[model samples]
Target: MPYHIDLFAVFILLGVVQAIFLSFFFLSRENRKNDVNFFQGLMLLSMAACILEIFLMYTGYIVDCLFLVDFSEPFALAIGPSFYLMIRSLIHGSVSRKMQLVHYIFPVVYFFLLIPFLIQSNDFKYNSWVYAYHPNLPFRDVSVGYDPRWLWVTDHHTLMSLVSIGIYFLFGLVEVIRAFKEKRESFFAPVHSVLKKLRSGILHMTSATVIIFVVKYLNIDDTGDHLFAAYISFTIYLTSFNVISHSGFFRQVALSEPQKYKSSGVTADAQKELLDKLAMLMTRDKPFLQSGFSLPELAGKLNTTVHVLSQVINDGLGKSFFEMVAEYRVEEAKRLLKEQPHVKVEEIAEQVGYNSKSSFNTAFKKISGKTPSEFRSA
Candidate 1:
């Protein structure tokens, strides 16, 4: 092993480690289980690729093992798709069966194209550009060969990923805005933390993609001197991983849930104002989102107490506070379902602050005389 780590290689190695750490750290949430299996698999695959690259960079930098240098390029190609899949999962809440097939699309396309140059050139093992290398003063002195021809296929890999990140970023932004807008129907009305995190991460990854290419194309390759540009790109990757996977990032998960406020018998205009305020409280302060939401707790939120809120619902809304709250929640859910038919029922229930599907279903049926699905379909 050599004592000198190529400043450039060291920089890239650090990026890989940081990405792996964040990936494992964020992807561990038990709640993200939708066909999350694909994303989970992609993360693991990307993790392995990072680990191998880190190992190769470390060995070549320290131990002078040249084989590692060349082996990691193929793995780099694999990273592109893993990122694409992660974006897909975050935005769609699951991967498409079609896109899963789409994952293999590029690697397969490149294998044949790259094979030609590999055999034509013996670089399999020297300067590592077209081949393997010893060290130079500037960097690891390795060149993975940017043959313009390589870009023909590799470019597709880059382009598709940029597109994936772009699409999810938009999807996530719309959902978040819908979640917060005081409107009757948010794009992701009753938007949840998963939607928020997914969106934020999508934005981060898109930036990362932009930075990496900007540096590569701008020739910021630096002979490995100031690798800050590349390091920042990888750190973004780390941030994105956490954004995608960490459940605690969901602020709602900690807030109390909306309770079925029991109606009080006090019918009047005064009560309608209170109901409007309740809607405002849920949207603004967000205490009603907690799974622990209780009539008493919420009344406390507006300084009125459970009794007054109950009176308002029963008298003004012609229902008990419990019924009114549930009604509000169900209606909120109903609106989202009507617009985003693509969202799952369970997710919609969660968004409106319901703890389970059965409760949402039972209440929805009681109010609308149909299941949420049936109402949506109608």
Candidate 2:
């Protein structure tokens, strides 16, 4: 068989490369600890695999490697579940192991069902591919020892895939909706911009996939798969562009500011020491409990310059000085709310160093996802 290549094939090949790269990028050890990254990595890998198979078949490359034909069918089933799980992880921090198992069962079963066809002779698989994708091509005569009942499943795979993806898309949409409702946030809300983008991206990608599948199947059955593959490539490119743009890597850096604390003179050792001192101060003295406690006063207590203290809190702890104080205050407030249930919310707020109840309510809700009254009542 002769090889075929075109601009469409090239586009798809590039998308496959990028999708695989991003899959590994997200799955890398540095990012694996994050549940969202882990599931997104899995989703990307599944998408890359499905697109790669489509690319090869669409470009006639599979003619040279018939044994690899249809290898990505099972992975196609995984795309929906992985995407759903990614959304779940984003909203809930992590998906339960049992839920993961349940979601993956369909893909696992499909893989098992595909094994028979996968092990068939090259001629058998080639004829199968030709029947589905290239009906004009001459079919080679081949004999199979037994009937592969799984062909029934493969016969309706397009519809099955569409339904599978649609079901999971609904699941993911519901999950996002529930999360937003519970958090009192909306997709249009200015807060949680990162999460909003993520949710919106997932929905758009999944919905686009569904539409592409429907159009492809309706217009040209399996032969129009390249169109679907092309869309997947476009989705991958869009995802990559979004990731880079949102990463802030290209944000303008002010020449005058240079680094955040280039002149602070705080060495790594001193930063760690300051962080330790800050932690000890919070634990031992609970200075955040003092109403109107100021950063300068905390710096004075730590015997460090305000700039150095700010750097310590921001760099070493990954939060601003005020954010760290707020966290401490909220934690103390929670303890008081739980242990001293009879205490009024105002008294608890005052005890946690907030001069006003409204300010305390805001901080408590921001950190704990609930107001003091709601938390106490729960």
Top-lDDT structure, candidate number = 2
Candidate 2 C-alpha lDDT tens digits along 242-289: 767555345555668758753555665557645655675688789899
Cα-based lDDT at residue 267, candidate 1: 33
Off by over 4 Å in 2: 149-151, 248-378
- Give each model's clash number: 31, 0
Which window of ten consecutive residues has the lowest lDDT sum in model 2? 245-254
Give stretches of model 1 more than 4 Å off.
1-3, 6-33, 40-63, 73-75, 78-80, 111-123, 129-192, 220-378
The global Cα lDDT (0 to 1) of model 2 is: 0.80
| Model 2 TM-score, all chains together | 0.70
317: Cα error in model 1, Å: 20
